[model samples]
Target: MTKRWHSLQNDRPFRPITLLPVTIAFSSGILMGFAPAPLNFFPLAWVALAPLWVLLFTPSKAKAQGEKNESKRPFFLFSFSFGISFVWGVGYHGLALSWITGLHPLTWLGVPWLASVAIVLFCWGFITVWGAVLVALWAWLMHRLESVGVKGKGEDDAALLSVHASTPWHHLEPLLRSLRRVLLGTALWCGLEWLWSLGPLDWTALAYTQSPGNLAVLHFGQISGATGVTAAIVAVNGLLAEAWMNGQQLAVSRQRSAVSSQQLKTQNSKLKTIALLVSATILFIAVHLLGAVLWLQPIAPSNTTALKVGIIQGNVPTRIKLGSDGIRRAMEGYTNGYLALAAQGVDAVLTPEGALPFLWNEPNKLRSPLYQAVLEKGAVLWLGTFTAQKGGIARSLLTITPNGATTSRYDKIKLVPLGEYIPFQAALGGIINLLSPITENGQPGAFHQQFDTPFGRAIASICYDSAFPEVFRTQAAAGGQFILTASNLDPYSEVLMAQHQAQDIMRAIETDRWAVRATNTGYSSIVDPHGHIEWRSQPRTYQTHAATIFRRETQTLYVRWGDWLTPSLLVLGAITVLFQRRSLRS
Candidate 1:
């Protein structure tokens, strides 16, 4: 069996070779879907790219022929397949939800399916191109390492040969040079994340899925933002990849030495390999256990006065939401819900994004009614509404005091691209109009805003805005103690979307602030400062959830420092790669 496995590894083309990694990647993704919070700590993200690494570093005709015709097709196919599989595993949940909810029912059929598939392909195409770039970079670095005479190949030459005959040192070099790569990669990924946060479709992220699982790690997030979470994810994956590579090398080396050496040498190598594996396993277990312990702990609010808050899920349809009557209905529903909550003696009432449906500038039809309700009930009202700003349409969350005083407004800085505003709209306005829903381009808002309540200052964000850590960080820094996230999830109401919504628990944990998330069509909840869900509504339910609010504690180290460790490692990683490449050139 071992021989056959080795034979297959050695003979297979890169396309076929990626099968295991792809399978593992997909399985990991599904596992993430099942238990997104706990299993998310597995560090399986880079495993998706394992095949790409193998393909690029493997001894192939392309490496020898220096740009042969046959190599091009195989390389492209390998990248394309890997991209499709990886992206499909990562993003198919959103697609499935889109279909199930009839948001794009046509997508359930041929045309939409093809279009969705094409979109996925287009997104992955960039990833594929990036992978190719990384491959070329790795090759250059490895050649440098070899040229500089980095010594000590482990006894596992045979196993390494099975994977990549020529670039046997690729794995070893990356491990030894990990510090540099970690630094560079961390910086690069974080920078990219920062840029991606600026995009309008704001909520999607690798760390968001893991938000609900571990509170302490998330507590560290309040200070660091999602960048901190990203760093942790990368660290675990890098460590695991290193450990696996080390184990493989040790195992192969021991086998080779056993065949050719004295009994003592064989015993020593075997012991070393076992020790390495054991250490890796121990580290992995310890990290997850620590995270779990942190997650399970209860958050003690500073004040006990416990404010009663009501979250109204309007469940307004997107098409209606775009129209005037839809806006009126949303406002009416929210106003009615607030009145009902006031009758129940709720201290405050919350509504989802675009609860007013119509742009705020539209003649004050809903405002007077909403103002009257707030004044009569003497209950604070937090509403998600849109406004016509100088740049374009802007989404905002407005907090009205019990006396009907409009206390503060938080404009959503992060806007969805096609849905809110087209990228490069000035140049591609025509194309964008045909493809997107933004009849009038959406505008970006200020990064942070706060509303002063009788209890304390509250920070609020619209749907996509909650995904960006910087917004929260800035708010927190500006003395916002509690977070109110208003979202309209009606368009993508699915178990997956619910799961995705639950990920916001991490935000609470990261910042040590309690969060009241009110969404359209369910998944509404109250999260404690520790990132645990105190209470949540059922999926697809147009109901109101009432919970006692809590105050945030002091800021964490992560907040003060902000992804310091990860970014440093990334810089080091980049430098090491560059140095190695230079040495090879020399």
Candidate 2:
């Protein structure tokens, strides 16, 4: 009777029957949202996922009951457990991406006040829903794998015998089982993150939560970019989840055991649970310790090459910049800032994206005082301007020599979705107006556009391109000495600027190069190869920063290997899962 009861209890799914678990999960997500920029409560991220992890690691009742039928597995997707997991994702994304609402009062874009509010809300809801849905899918996959793939496989137990045939491996079964679950969970998370990175909206990556803080963990990016830090987070969370699951099981075993042998088994389980908890704590500390070692390692010196670069931040309102009336303010602000920085003896000056309100070949641009100033300063100048191409307009950064000749140009490749160009414009253009100044879709630059500067070769990214590591990694691998990211972040809140700065810091660490950012409204900064911010500008203020930044040709492991860790882990996990199911059928 006791054995039968224990089996039944183990088979029963762990459900969020009460409001407490659901509330805790949601609250945890809210806390995690603060782990990234603006608030930067990074420590919360280390433990915030525990409740969600518990929910995901526990098998749902539907899956526990319907083990034989493949069709029945879909039932778990709609289970209450999925709802709980999704709620956490919503809570996290809602707070983290609150800056999306900064686009309010879009009257400047010819949008009515009420309509603007509705549009912003719709965008927020859509993105939040998409992010939350991904989380739910992650949880569902975890439950399905635990329930169907490896649950009752006898070969799993004997598979380890080749390593320790004579040892009492049965005594360590619980520990091994917990470790296997954690490994699988970590791999699944990394795979999901990789998928997210490929898309246009990738600001919500788990690793970004650690940036501008948690330097120890951020160092892991040097080896595997943001994916490595994400793997570490998922692994730690999985360990804690396993520990919690074991504790609950041990308590249940104590209540049900009656015979001496049963009592002995219960005591062993208790001992194993305690051991697992202790081991998990140790592993967590060890990961951070190793991270600290990596963080403290000496940064390789620049090859005797340094560029005194000046970054100009023009505090022009987005509304005016898009209008014809704001042309004077935009040109004067950049030209004046450039001249001031030039007087301070900067070798080169950089302007934020769209610094010149006119096209690159516009007659007005050549007549402007900015061109004459560039010629007189005899210093290299980089201008963020539009170039008229055969296909359409191209957002480009033009490099001008001391002789006032356009030496090189790098057109933006990763255009902002909906903001720069509307998708399915043929269908949606008539109904939905993006209110963008450009009527036609901006043309993307070639992927391998080489940017040659007076100092040397440099990696250039415009605005949204910084979010994609692959964009910078390829350039860095091609012997690019330094990184420059120019953005026009007008109208967005300072929170967005801070987040943008964090992304650049990660890119710097990943490529082992110094990064300089120039933005229209604030958070222009310089970052070292070690993910340290040397300088940052005040938001919504017209400011210029001139600093000596090094040019580094050193490529990090991530840049060389190119995000191999996450994909490799995903492939391995997939094979293991397939092997498990095949063994079950046999």
Candidate 3:
């Protein structure tokens, strides 16, 4: 009877729950959202993972002393499906991706108002929950690697570092184990992040949360892409976690404390020294600050050239953007802004995506006023329009020369999953059309980007292209002097616009080129090489302002090499996994 009751207790027929980990992990996810723009609580990201770390390392009663299967699993006592990891995912993405709710109206096209809201909420929650699951899985990987590093033989007692007191390995083991934990944590983070960047669901990179606000750490992004910044952040977080775990242990000399051998005394001293070093590194940001000066500083004045670039923000209404008839109003707004900017003697005038409201080839057919007016002013006009491709229309940058001729055309490579191109149109197409009228697909362009402009050789990152670092890096490496991004963020909230601009700032700093944005709705701004905003337009405003932006010929470590650090760390992680497996077997 007692054995049966004990077995049933573990099952918990009434309710099987671990409340603290669930609540804490979920709260940590909410805090993670506040680290990025619109909230801009920049400090939240540093400590956001602390709760989850505690969850991973803390010894629950059931976890510390339990049956073999229960104690042996990663995140002990927390069953995979019933654990706090999934709950954390819910809390994290719910707040971070609240923007999904705005797309609810699209579903009304096929269903009733109430039904649409229900469907939208279901979809939004489902997606956020799914993403949260991925994050939880990643946390499990990190904790497993950490456990394996500490316990030499994983199968034996599930204790951290089971060592004979007199063995020399134990003396040096503490220090090596701590360092290994940090590396393992960092590598696991980068590896999972790399996997996330593979497909249409690649928007939630943790590195973007650090940009434009975390100035001290932003310098690392210059040498490496955003991944470099992420690695540094993860390393610091990992060190802090290690410190929390081993805060009680102190180094003791045999002569001063007890009757230990001299060799053991020296080993303890070495262990203490290592702990202090790790603590100092995490608490101090000196190395990061120095890297900032060496790699982040802008080019000398003599080596740089400046151009007067104008950004046009036309606050087109939501109704106009969703309707075909709004093309006239959109064109009129862009034309007036273009001529006024031309009057300022701007070198080039950039308009947002869909500024012209028609095809580049058919601009004259819509009685297009800007093409001829811009040519008359002798300023290069770069705007977004549909360029006819082999199969369909490509969302591209249409660059007009002084003679009103389309000399350069750079097509958008990365298309938004549902917005630009609907995947598997034959099957998902009919279903998607019922939700939103987006019937056609936008064809993807080739990767090589080189745009010829009168002012200088520039590159155009069509709105969606801003998210992918490789797109802009390729342009910079190919001798792109200036980077211009054109986005048409109509009907989206200020939160969305700021998120997009935050990404632009990182691109500017990474490429060491001033990034000028021209958005149709708002938040058109210029970010310099040092990640400073030169000038910005207010949200939902119709105006054209020109900022003097600098052009650079130099290529940054990130721009030249492109995410080399991630691969290097992956190799390190593979080696750790090998040793960990071997230890587990023994």
What local distance difference test score does each model get?
A: 0.57, 0.78, 0.70
- Candidate that scores best on lDDT: 2
Clashes of 2: 0
Best by TM-score: 2
Candidate 1 lDDT by residue in tens digits, 525-559: 88877666778787765677677886664676555
Query: lDDT tens string, model 2, 2-73?
Result: 343234324324433346556777898998899999788998887888778765444333434534343265
Kindly give the stretch of ten consecutive residues in candidate 1 with the minimal lDDT sum. Answer: 146-155
Rank list by lDDT: 2, 3, 1
State the TM-score for model 1. Answer: 0.76
RMSD (CA, Å), each prediction: 6.2, 4.1, 5.4
Candidate 3 per-residue lDDT, tens place, 1-586, comes to 3233223234321245545446777898788878888788867777777666645543333432332344375554365433666676677677766766766565424556777677668767766866776777776665555444444333111133344334556555555566676677777777777776655565556777776687656767777888987787667766666555443222222334454554555556455556745664754375467556855554574424878888888777654654565776777788888888888888788888767665667645336777767666778888777777887888888778678777788888888776788888878888887765566688988888688777677867988788788888888888898888989776667877888888888888888888889888778998877778888899888888987877789887888898888889978877877775675455
TM-score of 3: 0.86
Q: How far is candidate 1 from the true structure (C-alpha RMSD, Å)?
A: 6.2
The local distance difference test score of model 1 is 0.57
Using Cα atoms with residue i matched to residue i, what is each candidate's TM-score against the true structure?
0.76, 0.90, 0.86
Stretches off by above 4 angstroms in model 2 are 1-18, 59-63, 66-77, 152-168, 300-303, 434-440, 582-586
